[model samples]
Target: MHAPRATSNPFVGLHHADTPLLLPNAWDHASALAMAGQGFRAIGTTSLAVAAAVGLPDGASATRDETLRLALLLGSQQFLLSVDAENGFSEDPDEVAEFARQLAAVGAVGINLEDGMGAVDRHAAKIAAVKSAVPGLFVNARTDTYWLGEHDETETLSRLDVYQQAGADGVFVPGLASAREIGALVARLDVPLNILYSPVGPAVPHLADLGVSRISFGSFLYRRSLGAALEAVVEIREGRRPGGRAPTYEDIQSLGADPARHD
Candidate 1:
């Protein structure tokens, strides 16, 4: 296995400053390298994109191997890579911790673990196990309370408290768009608060003002890429060139070129 490239992980320091880390989610190595080329410091894998790409169900613990393979592929890229291992792909905390260790061995700097509204204690156990096994891996504990159902500030805070106590480096609450609630949560947490960026919700500047330390475009880029491809096909079918400029074939292929050759 390739050793982690960075002697000191910059992914952790990205959360310490005032500027919120704008993390773009990538589905594959090419997508990740493309984002890295555009100057993103770090990239996260979107479980939805990964599962859909492989014709598996997301949040069902079905894409464990695929997720690991993607992590192995992207972990050594120029940019820091964070794998979204939904529920750690297992109910057993030990298994989750082992998986995290494997990811760290492959050069991943972070892992995103979601609760999916399961038992809070169980999720916290997994977080503790992962941290115990790989303390350097940034464990961004995610709660699906808002995404999966109604927003309960009390329950959200309760869960986040548990996760923070369990040693989560960051807390992610996706589908949470309310500026007031976000600020409230930010004030309540000791660690960085990660909010998923919604086009219809608060803008990036507004989120930074709300004290959000990280903004994740979770699965948005992947979905938008699919939309763009479909629109391009339809435009061709209707006898018109696509509106936006696309990457040249050579440029796209260059994303997969051996990095050492460039050096």
Candidate 2:
């Protein structure tokens, strides 16, 4: 069954909250439900995890079907969902918008579209098409200026300006970590500014202090889960207990019992 639509879009308000929205990126149904069970109000799909789960390369637009399948499975759940659709799986503006429309129809409230350092006008066109196709979908326009290569302050501001004008609900800079620069961007952006959380950089409170509207843990949790599982098996082989929390089989079984779980 499809999830019933909420009376209003709650995702937009999340960015404007007193405290920044801490978005946990989940890979599969169990992980998403597990996070929702922990009182997270929203969950995002990590494209890396999604592609890696199916043995496909990320950022190559190879996980469109996998991404949609996961969305179909988790979209009916209680929490809001924002999918990390890498470049919308197409460079064509209309195609990207159609993909976003499909995502919105399945109950996703937001979509993260990265430019991948492509043409500024082309990415802006995709964003504009998406806004036109699904007006309610929160378009988190991402610019990979720092992610792909050296950080150019001028290019960053210019791309973000075009995206904002293209009707992006928010803007994301994934590799950005400088506090002063982040503060400067926050001071200039008219819409919400989303910063990908870096462990070596500023802490969550520090980002919030800098006026970041949303902080995303992109692929961090998924990678940690993999590391934890590998460590657990190695520890068992060495006749030692695992150092981290391992959910019981029954606990995992409980995750699928309800779409919305309460403490």
Candidate 3:
């Protein structure tokens, strides 16, 4: 298995207004390989999928090992892999820095670190530590201000300001889904802006037009895949073929051996 070229902070910054990063959220190696074959330059792991599949909880920082293992697997493949380390799995900056180091050692190119509605100063410190530990890893600093119902613009700006000053390459807003707000944020920030994709929310093209540099699917694809699998099982029980253009078993075998190959 050939490893992909190591990524830098500029790799994430390359995605921009006219060409936003269409990041596909992967649950495991096979899915990630499939999307990589389909021409996605970078792949992001979904925390919800990793947690749910292992029967553990999601976003409470219960999947550190799982996240690392997945990153190790994808790192050998021919694409940039970004691990979602929710809240850095601890409030302590040292632990988060260690986690970032593990990911960088395994060939991961980027990491998603979230505030998780924690203290802004603490999260900023964590981001700084992660950067100190893994200088090449693209740190996408996430703020959950809108998701947590404290949508105070002043406070949100203050938190992001701290993160950017602390050396975050990009900032992510998971639940922000407005063109006006997004435009304002993009115009104000010096670093790249990442927006989470919502099915009912703004589309990728719309987000690109609004000046978003990166668009993350988060857990949307993972949940949608689960929904699709359940629906397929029900359809089979009803004496009908399942939906989706699935690959054959042999195709999957080939992917296991070499993920970069589509056929």
TM-score of each: 0.96, 0.95, 0.92
Kindly report which residue stretches of model 1 are placed more than 4 angstroms away from their true locations once superposed. Answer: 1-8
lDDT tens readout by residue for model 2, 1-263: 11212336799888888889999999999999899878899999999999999999999999999999999988888899999999999999999999999999999999999999999999999999999999889999999999995799889999999999998989999999999999999888888999998889899999999999999999999998998899999999999987977799998998878644543
Candidate 1's displacement at residue 255, Å, is 0.8
Candidate 3 displacement at residue 11 in angstroms: 2.4
Worst 10 residues of 1 by lDDT: 1-10
TM-score of 1: 0.96
lDDT of 3 by residue, 73-146 (tens): 99867788888888999999999999999998988888999898888899999999998998888898999999
lDDT of 1 by residue, 82-103 (tens): 9999999999999999999999
Better of 1 and 2 by lDDT: 2
lDDT of each: 0.91, 0.92, 0.85
User: In order, what is each prediction's RMSD in angstroms?
Assistant: 4.0, 4.3, 4.3
Residue pairs with backbone overlap in model 2: none
* Index of the highest-TM-score prediction: 1
**lDDT of model 3 at residue 111?**
92
Counting only residues 3 or more apart in sequence or on different chains, how many pairs clash (N, Cα, C under 3 Å) in candidate 2?
A: 0
Compute the lDDT for candidate 3. Answer: 0.85
